[model samples]
Target chain A: MATHRFDPNFTDNVINSMGPKTSPRLRQLMTGLIKHVHDFARENELTVDEWMAGVKLLNWAGQMSDDKRNEGQLVCDVIGLESLVDEITFTLADEAKDAPTATAILGPFFRADTPYRENGADIVVTKPKDGEMAFMHGRVMDFETKTPLVGATVEVWQASTNGLYEQQDENQVEFNLRGKFKTDADGRYYFYCLRPTPYPVPDDGPAGRMLQLMDRHPFRPAHIHIIATHDGYRPLTTQIFDRKDKYLDNDSVFAVKDSLVVDFVERKDDPQAGLELNYDVKLVADAK
Target chain B: MATHRFDPNFTDNVINSMGPKTSPRLRQLMTGLIKHVHDFARENELTVDEWMAGVKLLNWAGQMSDDKRNEGQLVCDVIGLESLVDEITFTLADEAKDAPTATAILGPFFRADTPYRENGADIVVTKPKDGEMAFMHGRVMDFETKTPLVGATVEVWQASTNGLYEQQDENQVEFNLRGKFKTDADGRYYFYCLRPTPYPVPDDGPAGRMLQLMDRHPFRPAHIHIIATHDGYRPLTTQIFDRKDKYLDNDSVFAVKDSLVVDFVERKDDPQAGLELNYDVKLVADAK
Candidate 1:
């Protein structure tokens, strides 16, 4: 009942409005959210114009979002919220030295129904003239037992040299640079595709405008998106970065993990030169 | 640069990522936001499922929003952030005894082309069969001078007895229960319309689903929405609640202020009985 003083932080009033059927967990979450948000507005002494600007930005994000795009999620990514949640939710405890590979954002570009392919197959349906193919191979293993995870499904996708995911660039064929492979008996999976390139998060919308206002570049590091999964093990969605990419340290999405960065070795005069990248992934067993 | 320990609260890392050209005000605002949002997720020990649920909820809100509706804003309103911002931004310093009338949310229903009618014209184009007419009049005044603002604009709109605005209900005549009037020489404006009714906020979308999860009712109280404006004084957009409405204390939007509540006197068998509801508005002069 905050009255007279115009103290709209009637936190109790709002909390009290909850009905008896409300979930205790939701109550706790809503309580914390209301307190922090109220404090944010009050401490900032946020003006009408500023508040409305935030509202309009969110509205713009909603308007710009659709099947092939998610401006709302992009807002979270650029603000570091998505990465924070990923870290908090998926990061293993420090007590475990043999943790699984680090998790990364399942960015907006991921699409379902990826074509399945055999080992050492190429995912680039039609490689660009300017693109150079890279050899990518890895072993998926069980973390605690240090054994190979036979028959694990490994899905991979990457941007073309132009930095646009296939779905975003109409000129590219559907499912270009995207595929899934079942690991061999030794837990090995391999594929050939154009190397991932640093790219901007879509900036034609409100979230992109935020980067513009921050004077921050929207480029994510050159990284291959991967998902390794097998029954009885936790599915890991992650990105492995080319260590040499300029955006590694300051990824627009704040999603880079030290353990997830690997060198795309260079062998100038050899056939395999600048063409090979080996990344082994470990999976944490799902608690029985 | 939080690393190894999975301390994603990399507050400085994200803050430092801002470009040198970022506005100082935006930097401060973002720093506060990042800290608060991160603390919220971390303190709650947020899980992947829970975080994803939030992301999905926001996505649903964005997808459900368009020209006729703004689910993102509804999310803010149901959470009380909009009201808190309005209070903090518009509430004058404690020393100003003659402060302007309290402000309220310019809810999603406001339309730009409100018909300009003479002082006593009725806004109800075609009255509902079950509706009872209410006579509403208001005066606009300068707070400090306590003088009438002749020719001030008084715009009013309210929900019909069925709890639907014109645009939301196709069956209703256009501009029903909405009109704008210029004050008479005495700063008086009047219009007849159906009495306001308590109504639920749009609950089919994510914001409404949130209220359902909280076991909270989505209804706002019976009230008349008004905006008083003149050449020099600050415009006051506010709501005057009917003292007898049950939802007055638990308004879904957290917008009911003590200073803005009024009793809608009920008239006996007499023609003029229970019909008179007069409210006066005060506006602070815009600072030079």
Candidate 2:
């Protein structure tokens, strides 16, 4: 019988042949990628059908992507890859004792060039139907010094209570529920918006099919996304999850960090019948 | 700083949630896939840019694939995954010691229901431009008995010397280099065709870009594909490589098996002005 055992030199041959003259960083990345992927296939004894299924899923996800939607990013998020990579790469240096705000995946909905507004500006241009108003106020501070970071840029966005971003729903005004605000002299920023509600990710695409096949829900917990930046501090991108959202413990993207969850206090007497949430952001110093 | 170390339970959480009610085999597969992918990301400290680049590559490959071309399959082939899986899954049973023919990937080009032709029939319906003629003859035998298997279906195909398959080139007639022949009572089958030539895989897509980035050649060695099937014997799919082909040692797909390589002898006096090749295929029985 012919030898069917694993070839000892296969990995080396593939790596050496494919990575000879690329940039050093590219070579290193490719080598590690090849080794891990090859080892995974061998260890799993992956069958042809399984491999073909994976290819088909990826193909479908690609086909589903468009200028406004990124199905591939959704796939990565659903598979927990986006969050895992974010966690790994955003780890703070050990010497910094104070805890900075945790990082979250910059999901596919982010759009640049949002119009800047003064602190405490109401971001909701058209009130969403069946949506309860909410006031999200937060303070931006330096992690090391505990000093307020005045004039910090706080970019905030979240899906409507209907779980659709402005770009995704034609009924909503352009850039609805999206705005940029500056921290006041007291280092506080606030925006009036609809309370986020737990919603399923787009379920009509290949990523949704993958989630279904995996027996997992496609829901992400109610959350508000924020990107806070100051001149002398590292940019902080994170999401604040409502403490009462049912999907918090089982966020589809695995992006819910304990420190990023906050409670929204119900303010029944308010004219808008709004909820109030206060969160504090801490940014790491840019350098030693 | 907050704990940024690897979440010890993260792997288990993903696996358990994603695989709760899936089939046992699927559960096992998903579990392994999640672990390996997460571990690979963490180990490589994969940057966001690198991850997004991979996503873009996959997206491009999917967009490039359609009914006629399989860019995703090409990606798998160039990554050496198709051949690796074929090798692992096609290993012969230990008890059936007689060496059966080796297997290769059923590439994306294979189409079912090809028309059958009589023995000694020439498969090249249109003489390819700048192509050298070749006459290929082979016998199908039972591995254990060394006896001919009559009435076996021998399907054959190959790219022209110009490195184009019939479907790929408009000038070539439909099914030009593709045909099926039946073995005679002596288990012999013969067909006239062009000598297979080394060819670059379609390099205008994502897979090609990957090859270029890796500093690797995209050429597959010269080879002929055959699939032999008899009523009571297991079907054998394989490729016969031209021993003199320069790419034999470094086929883009890593499909060059030592046992599948053969010499193509030149015939000076033949009317066809062709090369002659003889291959004997040994098929294992269906059951003990």
Candidate 3:
């Protein structure tokens, strides 16, 4: 066999050879990826055992993901990668940073084709409710003009008080705690559901094990997911966090933006014996 | 919900909370990983779409790996991460850097329990061999003392001229071109097999697609893998490359070290119609 030496130019040689004819975008992305990944391994002086362990982790994460669960997304979340990407992609102009509603991660639990309900309709389809009832009322408006956006579709979903989404808990009815509402003439939308409560993300997979190994909790702050869309306006996907939830200070997903937090007012005299939450969403107009 | 602000401290808060009680090694690994991943996203201004693309790639890589295939390992190889890790983990002391045999990646194709063959025995188990025959002879010695090590187990395996290992090509017999041999008293060992040839890595999976997208070729240079172990010496796993191979300078896996390259001498008068190769291995002793 021929004997060759180990030179420092190995990385550049590999990069140059691998990206000769790729599209400019792909070339740029691959170049950055190669440099960062190579630098990361060298800087850490990573061992073969560590590399193999990572391989196993990735394999486990892939094998654990399915229609109802996405461990890869969870991996990104646990490492704060998703949040960083969101910050980079959604950072608003200095003057409008606080004007528009802050965006958060579109977590793995979201589902499409949710049933649409009328304003003030109850979305808790499960029988014999086990958690405190709550009403969430909100308005959707154009960011700059503050004009109500009538006919805006407000899609909402959240985990039950027990910390499990409807799809994750077999006992809950299909589409439980999930529904869509259309804004009325005044750009108002309302729905009745259980109060949001802090709940642990699924801890049965590699992602959960990763959290355990890191000495970190898997709980996300009590929050309601919202995706609002209207013609001529950019879609807004965010979560409204309950300020009192303990996990807010250390959300496992790093998705807690201050502007996305709000109060859940206790109403002891209400017939529903639950809390009331009011939130307003401001969305940017879609660029022409 | 309570109106909270988007604090810039979120990343630090998560990092601090997640690593308090972990082992020092785990803490360091996690800390560096979190920081680099976050920085990569932020520096590149990674978009949500781009992040999702990454997630999809990871998912595909994971799902594509199995008993006979390892897409994750291939992903690392393509990104130059495995080579970097190997470099860091196996780097020799400055004084002896050039004295010892160089190490290479233990690729996904390596399998344990290969059958042992006697010295000068042919490892090719297939009938009517299509490629020219070759003989590989080498000696094992201590790096500093230059003393031969007897009874050293030298395991060897390589793809056929068609660029497929026995396991990857079912038409070939089990353990074809794979054997383990013990060195003689003089630390000499020899085996007969087909000449190695450059072949493309498996491209039917996500890893292959990644290479195609990046316009990168998957062909590794013509080479043979060797793993030698002895009683009082550290095990060495490496590959010897054929210097004349077209892909020598651009091995798809980035595993070509300068010292691991060698000549495949053609013997025109040999009845077997093959080439001869000679390589000497220098091993580092096990720590006392």
Candidate 4:
């Protein structure tokens, strides 16, 4: 017998065989995804055995995720897919100037809303034993015009003194070291809270294991999380890392920026600032 | 002053943080995605320097693709994402028994519909001036019952005697050695053609370059393309390969199977067989 030949558009036939029209967007997405995926199979000359192993890895990734934790996201970040998408979204805003604030990944720890309080308030109502007190103040303004954005809202949050988000540690207060403050007529708002310390993202997950297997480190630098907003301004999601932290250059979330780094000045017993120490912030409005 | 903490589900504030309420799905996807992306940044301690390099890589992958090729797919495939999705879809089929024929990637060469033809006809109407004539025969069947599937239509195509798909070789005849054949009453189909030798997938593309960089090979095993179908029975889109080919176990497309490998016996002069070749095909209704 000679080689009997034929065309095998197996992929198109199979996908088309799935029936009914899909939205152009979704179709384009799936099609593009499929092409890349299939091309990969061809390019690697992937064997059946190797293909099966990939399936098992994904299953393990899924198993590592739960209500209290999601390891899948961590894996995505490590593999660079998360950053790729973030870069895309970040670019949608104006690129001419420094982003009003450093736009960074909103780490897995954020929960919606902190209680709103008047200016010059504290977020750490019940202080956890571990972290120190830091009084933070910030004013929101248009980056180009340098005009203060009065009535702007600034939400601040941080891990408990034990170096964990409230959700991650059952022992911590429900929303410890987290609060919402609105700027006064001068576009200034202040809040006091326990200082954040370097913490490790859950290393028990598949992502952590991969990092370990790959010999990559997992510590994130200390940082205060903030989301600032004002009318006609693009909301800014950012973090302020301690300049002295060891992992500042390697903040696992890749959120650090030169301008966003702040010194946690020590004021042993300064009561005039209403707390043991004071920190100041200059906010830039989210632009169109 | 103190940090004012609130409930984990601080509806009034965090809710207000997101301008317009997103659909539950969008919210879930975005939040999960954001967290993971941010986490990756944190874990890698990714700095602005490294982030720029990543952006550059993505741009390169994108620029590598064009109308005649898809490099992005190749990159994703090598990373195992393509196989992950393929396996997921395979496992999630409505019924394991209803699986369609083992589907593989449609290489970039496929161009819509090839010219259709009649039953028991030769597809390679014009053979390479230097290649030897060979006769191929096969029968389409229901794999589960091992019964002949009469009246089934089989469409076939392949690269010319040189072993290059039509789109890739401008020197070869357009739609060369490509045609369709309907299975006879006895479920047998035969055609006159030359043996197809093993060939390399396009290596000038990004996938090829990546393979080169990774020290991987690009050769696909010798195989004949065939698609068998009949109404009421699932369509079979598959290929039969010569077992002796060097790339059998390492098909770039991951398309080979134990059952798909068929021996191509060498035949001497036999005028009665009209080119001295015998071929048979065995097929099953596209797996449920």
- By TM-score, the best candidate is 1
lDDT of 4 by residue, B1-288 (tens): 212221112222212223244455434433443433443443333444345444333334445555444555554443334434444444344245644356444344555567666655566665667665567777777757768888877776666656677656777677777777778888887777666678776666545654454445666777777766776575545567777788886666556666667766666674422343354544444443
Identify the superior model by DockQ, candidate 3 or candidate 4.
3
Off by over 4 Å in 3: A1-7, A92-98, A127-129, A267-273, B1-10, B92-98, B127-129, B268-273
lDDT, residue A66, candidate 2: 75
- For candidate 3, the TM-score is 0.93
**What are the lDDT figures for the candidates, one per model?**
0.82, 0.82, 0.82, 0.58
DockQ (model 4, Cα): 0.03
Q: By DockQ, highest first, what's the ranking?
A: 1, 2, 3, 4
- Write one digit per residue (lDDT tens) for candidate 1, span A1-288: 433354544767777778889898998888888877776777667776788788788777776777888888899888888888787777533234555678888888888888889897778886787877778888999987879989999999999888898889988898989999998999999888777788888889987899998899999999999988999988889998988899999999999989999887643553532587888889888776
Predicted complex 2: DockQ: 0.60
* Tens digit of per-residue lDDT, candidate 3, span A221-267: 99999999999887888898988889888888889988899998876
- Model 4 misplaced regions, further than 4 Å: A1-28, A39-53, A63-68, A96-98, A268-288, B1-288
Better of 1 and 3 by TM-score: 1
Q: Each model's number of backbone clashes?
A: 3, 0, 24, 39
- Docking tier of model 1: it is medium
Model 1 — interface RMS deviation? 1.6
